[model samples]
Target: MTRDFDDDAPRRLQDAGGLINARRRDEAERIRARQRDDDERIYVVTTNLVIDAQEQLARRRRLDRIWRAGAALSWLSLLAAVIGTGIAWGTTGDLARFVVGYLICGGLFLMSLLTLVGVYFAGRNVSSLQRLEAHLASQQKALWQLKVKSNPDVDERGKLYREEVTTAIEYYQADSRKYRTIHNRHRRPRRLCGRCGQLKRIARNARDGQPDLCDGCYQGPDAICSICSRIRSCASRDEQGQPVCVTCYQRHRTGEPCARCGRTKAVNTRWPIGPVCVTCYTAVLRSPAECPRCGMVQPLIARDDDGAEVCGPCVGFAADYTCKQCGRAGNPHSRGRCAHCVLAERVNALLAGPDGTITPQLEPLAAALADAPSPFPAIQWLKESPNTKLLARLASEGHELSHELLDELPPNRNQRYIRRLLVHTGVLEERNEDLDRIPSWLEHELADKPTAHASLARPFLHWFLLRRARQRAAMRRHPACADRDLRRRVSVALDFLAWTDQRGLALADLAQEHIDDWIAGATSQRRYMIRYFLKWTTSRRLTRELTVPSIPSQEPQDLLDDDDRWRLLQRCLTDDALPPDVRAGGAITLLFGTSTERLCHLTPEHLKFDDEHAHLVLGRHPVLLPPRLAELLRQLAEQPQLRPQLSRAHPGPQWLFPGMVPGKPISTHGMTQKINRTASRSAPRATGRCPPSLLISPARSSPT
Candidate 1:
């Protein structure tokens, strides 16, 4: 029984040990469950905190985007408003439209400016929110760290938790400080105006103190001048003991009595000796001087040949001799004969007998001179004049005198004067041709055709002639070239009309086929000349719709090669004997490739000179003139006699190459002829090679 008891005790002890171990395990399990609950609670809290922080950050980012969008929209609106303003300014023509456009644009611009200010403040707010979000994120991180800490001691755990809380609080405080900084950065101070009671930005005056009123409501001090009663900062006391502005002060100072006249009028005229009134100054200029010849005092004076001052009447008496016949003061002449007497003597010699009696051959001229008011010009034409002899000879032959017959005579100034005299004396009648009187060639050509044909073509013929007459009248100064062109155009029209009339085709029924047929029959060189007539007929609606074939462009056959150009340039540069007009014209053509027509029209006005260089307005831009060409043009400008005679109807300055008539440029044909003569003389000499085509071609056909 004792041995069984010992073994059972050991077993019971082992069982007791096992039971203690199980109890300890059960306690540990309960503690672990509690710890897990705490951990889960901390994790849930941390997660919630993180989610809230993320949401706030997301909200801040959205706010930031909104601010950025607002800023972009404000800038875009500003740009659009600016563009609209520019468009309005440029396109609006009337005052009302301009005002409306400007108002609209201004309103848009102001709104955009206000929107931009709002966007800036919104952006600052977003930054503050972002900082707050950062603070929240920092708190979340600290909470997470606290949750993961494994400290067993309560004090240590509490210390860790307190440190995290303190850190979060510090972060929160820092974020708040940052937010305040951002807010303050954008904030502006405002104050209420004392006078207007309106909130406005503070504006301090350094001269005085800050104004209690806004700029709109402020009315400070009055600086009214006592003399002018005008508000001016420049007001001060004048010497007259009155408050005055600078303008009034100056007027008062100048209003003092003049030293010479003692008048209160403002002294305008000042002399080196003293101030003089305008009236006194004028009196000084008009002071009387004693005449040396007549011993008379006169206001106006003149210098005599001996350098003696003389009165106006005395000077005129001394300078001019009295004509015994007309009792007029005239220039001195030979044998005590005045200008009129000398001219009259020459006229009497031409038209009178040896006994000084008027001859029958010149009775009409003598009668006209007797009837004239002033016969000096008529008498002047008889002195050593060829037109006088021609007229005498015509009168001696008993020829029927008319303007047409006189026009057949050679053109001369004296001849024109004699014709005017004859017309005035009724010896010659002016010729006025009837409109039906066509050219002899056309008249004879139409006589052979049917009367109906002539009648049908008469209107067209009249039209052509009338058009030519109009052109001639417009360009009568350029008669030679104008007549030549008119002849060519009229001849073409006549021939075309004759051809169509012979074919029995009415002008209104005319077609392109008839025109093409005429063109085919015409000379190949002149086939295109009919295009002008066709255009005229079409414009007059005398024919049906017609499309004249275009004249084919011909390749230039006279382009100057390099060697030819060099030789031509050398001729222009080295040849001193060449006429200046030719040399200048050739240089201009070779350098600028200008046509003769354009060159003829060039005036001194087109040549511009500065301190540095000379320029020629050739085309759209000015061409810098070469030194040689500039010197030649200067010489040309100095020679006024080189200009052609201008008509009495249209008198102007002479051209570089004046035409036969006054006030007209040189004829293109005449220039071409002159250039041809020059080119012929200056043809290049070669060494065993053919002359260049450029040198061989006539100047009229040569390329510029």
Candidate 2:
């Protein structure tokens, strides 16, 4: 029989057994010879090697098609369900025809619902396959190399290795209680990374049956850390034990108690005498002192045998302590320049104009920052503070360093900070921050408001509210409350105008009935605010005389009884365990009914110390304090440690109640909170009057 040969005859003959195909198959098998892994591609490609890469590519394309098909099936099912429901409900015909339509609809709906459920599973499969492909791509090349190079492989070494890799990938992808034990067991054989002291995995060596270094740490060699004098990776242990570069090591290290300063903090280095924290180390290194033992002007780092101070050189320490620029005996920070010089350089660089020189306007600020008591903080602030960028841009652009220019920028916290810094440094003249910020805040608040509302609000904010605020500010009083009230009034005014606009009414046409309606619907505080706006508008003759009923002030219903009041006063006098500020502040609140606002603003000047008695000058008259309360106030006033370090550095009236912010008294709200926590029940509950029991003497009023 003569067999007719077609075009596919040669390919079929080759498929049976061809030399070229056999050669390719041998190479592929050789590549995977040691790879005893139950890998799908390896299992499927026993005879056909030419199809491996092509098949892998085709699998990815096929997944894409499968995903698209699933999505199309989902849409088709949705369309069928919608059309079937519409046909079933909307069809109008004979009863038999309606029944037939309903049956067809039910069948279509059932089939579509089944199709949708299958599509949902198909979608999930596609998503899982895509995730597997991503994991395979990230690791396949390296894993193949590792598996091929694996020497004297075990019977199922490739299988175990592949399973572990897959588990690791899946474990990282999502944590599961099922995989947790396996994951932890795989991670149990951990060793300190040779590069960093951080713990890492130790893979098993197939030949030696011993642990080997993980792939990551094995790629790098350890180097000497110049600062710590340790053989470590170029990365040093930073804050929270995170690895950071060597240059930032000192700044980022987790701190310990320094032997010299006796403070728990980040130490710069281990000196001859003891561990020294960064601040103390920098202070000693920068400030040269005459060594009592060596009689040489150098940084006094250690005490001698006789307990006399000595320099690094006197103690035979090898580190260089000479500033190359000034020839001063100090540990230089960068480029052999002392910290002071480096700070000055950085400031000059930050404030330099196009001509590479500090402008006269910014000279004072530059001088102040450079001449800071501690240069390290100044350097750090310049390096990391966001405010530095604002200052740099202003300086580089040669903009005049004035209050108006700062006010022109957005009224953000950073802008306010820069303005305060400039004023503190005498680069800009001082102004009332609270009073000055209102107009800027108003500008931002009104930027998006309707023109009609803006017209009504601008004058109310500027002429009436700001004028009264300025008068208060002029009297050397803080206008924090006034500023808050002004902003509230303006916000309410705009809301009222918007309300009127929504109802197609104008402010000029706003009647007493409308004002009454507005007041009735508003909150108590808001009612008062709207009344304030109405009062302002009436005074300006912008609107007709409108009667906004005043919110009646409710009298106190929770005043302390006579016995309780006396007991609280006695506690204030005798309770030494109570915080001094709280005791003093609570006593004043109980006796004279002084508000928290008045208490926070009380300066040392407000206390009149006479021969026999002390008087707190609360208002126009000075109220005499009892002997014990007088003593408490005296102790608070005279103690230097009571004031913040920053407050002491500046020239200002010392607050009786000092706050954390320099040159500012404790905020009224803060004072109120503190008093409420400890002695709120002691407070006089009446609005304007003190308790009537104050007229009686403490000895006579004592409870029998």
**Could you say which candidate leads in lDDT?**
2
Best by TM-score: 2
**What is the lDDT for 458 in model 2?**
82
Model 2, span 414-479: residue lDDT tens: 897788777766677777777678888888888899887777788887888888778876786443
Candidate 2 stretches with Cα past 4 Å from truth are 1-291, 294-300, 305-338, 471-481, 552-598, 602-704
Clashing pairs in 2: none
Question: Candidate 1 overall Cα lDDT vs. reference?
Answer: 0.60
Give all TM-scores, in the order shown: 0.35, 0.52
Residue-level lDDT of model 1, residues 117-143, one tens digit each, is 765675564446757666776767767
RMSD of 1: 42.3
Give lDDT per model, in order. 0.60, 0.70
In candidate 1 the C-alpha lDDT for residue 13 amounts to 94
Q: Give candidate 2's total backbone clashes.
A: 0
